[model samples]
Target: MASVSNPILVTGEPYTPGLTREAVCETYGVLVDEIAKLGSAENPLGPSPKALIAIAAAMGLTEQYPSWTAEPLRKAIAARYDVAPDEVVCGTGETEVISFIIRAYAGVGDKILMYRPCFPIYHLFAENEGRVPVYVDMGREMDFRVDAYVEALKSEPIRIAFLTNPHSPSGKLMAEADIRRICEAAGDALVVMDEAYIHFTETEGSLHLVKEFPNLIVLRTFSKAFGLAGLRAGFGIAAPEIIRPLWNIKPTWNMGHMQMAGAAAALTDHEHIRRTVDLIVEMRGYIAQRMSGLTAFRMVPGSRSNFFLIEVMDDRLDSTIVFEKLLERGVIIKDGSVSFRGLDKRFLRSDVGSKVNMDRLADALAAIEQSL
Candidate 1:
């Protein structure tokens, strides 16, 4: 018999998402509303009010197809970033855009550079397309070393390189200067700056870098700060030359009417965005301070995004133990032992949630510590 599927995908690991709120409810007998849901870095305050209104209003358009280009959403994104509409290419989500870039630029066996313990989509997409994923170590503490990355870029022929600003899992924000050095070293290779969580940080981010480096592409999403994750609306910005190919190859009407409408309205909701950022900032500090006294584990310092990592210090309790214990208390988070590639049992990633959610997590951890 002939082979029926791509061998790489047949053998490769699929991306593993965090446990859902309903899953916790089923397994632990917790109420659906009682779950803290600190696992998937969702907006603690929920979707923007304006976005919800827009989505409801656009419900009538469900029978008709959406714009082939997602023009309105693209224009809103362009105006927000000071980029041209033609320079933007919309997708169902940033993951779709990532797949598009991998498919368009890299051929089979081509090398795609990325940091170890990344978002996992980068590696998974490359493998799905039969491209090689080359990883640079993020160090034991998940620190980004520009020199090491630059060296890797120049080491061989790399077709594309993915850098996550305010990197995932760790949430450490890389400096602009360091990103510039990497772009300079990339030369002809395409550099993708995944800025999904950039809104959580104070920095202006690398959107401007797209103008400076023609080979650079900056990916943005309404999922994180804009609170439109369920809509799956995201776009990429780059030189018109790079975006043109992506636009041509992308599926027509990739974004639905509600996604386009909701995302566009969410972009204009500055107050909602501001409140979301303020909440993340406040709860992050609150949880950090609350967890400071725990002797079993310590919060990993220097995260500028909505989530941060907690490393279990006591040898008896690994990330798995802590993760299961938290689930028993209705506090859910990412267990590094299974979710992240390079991290071990000592680490877990927790999203900064509302005061109530953070309190649940802190209290759960304190109880676990007391038992230990």
Candidate 2:
């Protein structure tokens, strides 16, 4: 047997730098009565009340193992997306399902294709599973060119293609034409569309495309709009043929009883999803508008998504420096420099938080500049 490296090692350091409790409270400035967390990309809005109720109800059933197939969640996902129950597979979260898909579909000598400065986990998992990950460049210039993706696929034996529509970090939305084109070009390869941020976008998602393409797998998570990251529940929608293998690859009774119940309840909470998405969109607009007025940083074009990137030209303050400075001031944002080697030290990424929280970030950055 040949020795192989673990793919999990490829991940960046949790993306959350260390922070003191006092520092966090100072930056967010939340009273004990109010909740304030702006670090993670999670929805600022809390979990749905329905999800809360379900989790409470599920507490009594904790002793039992979850259904072997997570049938209830699978059914709910299928109904929500207008797909057959068998066409859905519930996992601990979309990331776990992504791992299962990549590990099951490809291995040594196989290759995977995805864009650079993406979800990071895709690259991490590819390396762990002994697969080659080809990254296509994306940035302020070409709007994460789909043509490059097509060209890459044309030349590569791409076993799988992982795409984050309205991509993370850059928040660049892909045109419908591009998605259809990629689907057509992929041939037998499995196309995994990570739509974790889709709930924040106005554009329609590619979930429905599963009816037409067996190779298309849409990964959805409640972590964002539904505000259930803590629960760790997500699902995959695809043709029943594709979903079956994913189901086999998933851990037995993977999603706990509480998570399933919470996710199922969240699926029915239209008001929560709607209100949360509205808040994110509003905050995103606010960030874009504020950044537009500033000359110090290069602001990437905003999409209807919940995140964006800012490029700081000041060589003295790399994202890591800014990250540490923000930590001292009680704020936290992802450092794009580590994951995006193509990006200079000045690039840092932040997600849409509440207006107050975002304002604090803007003020902090301005203060940091003035101090420099």
Q: Which candidate should be chosen as best, given lDDT against the real structure?
A: 1
For candidate 1, the TM-score is 0.98
- Model 2, span 1-372: residue lDDT tens: 654365445553343332334556666564432332454678777899999999999999989888878988888877877778888888888888998899788877699998877887887677767688898887454286788898888888999998998787677788777888999999999999999988888766998788877789999998888999889988888887888887788777788889989999999999998899889888888877776666556566756577778788677777888877766666667677775546667777777789987887777777787887
For every candidate, C-alpha RMSD to the true structure in Å: 1.2, 3.1
Residue lDDT tens for model 1, 213-240: 9999999998989888888989999999
Q: Give model 1's clash tally.
A: 0
- How far is 315's C-alpha from truth in model 1 (Å)? 0.5
Off by over 4 Å in 2: 1-37, 339-341
Best by TM-score: 1
TM-score attained by model 2 = 0.91
TM-score per candidate, in order?
0.98, 0.91
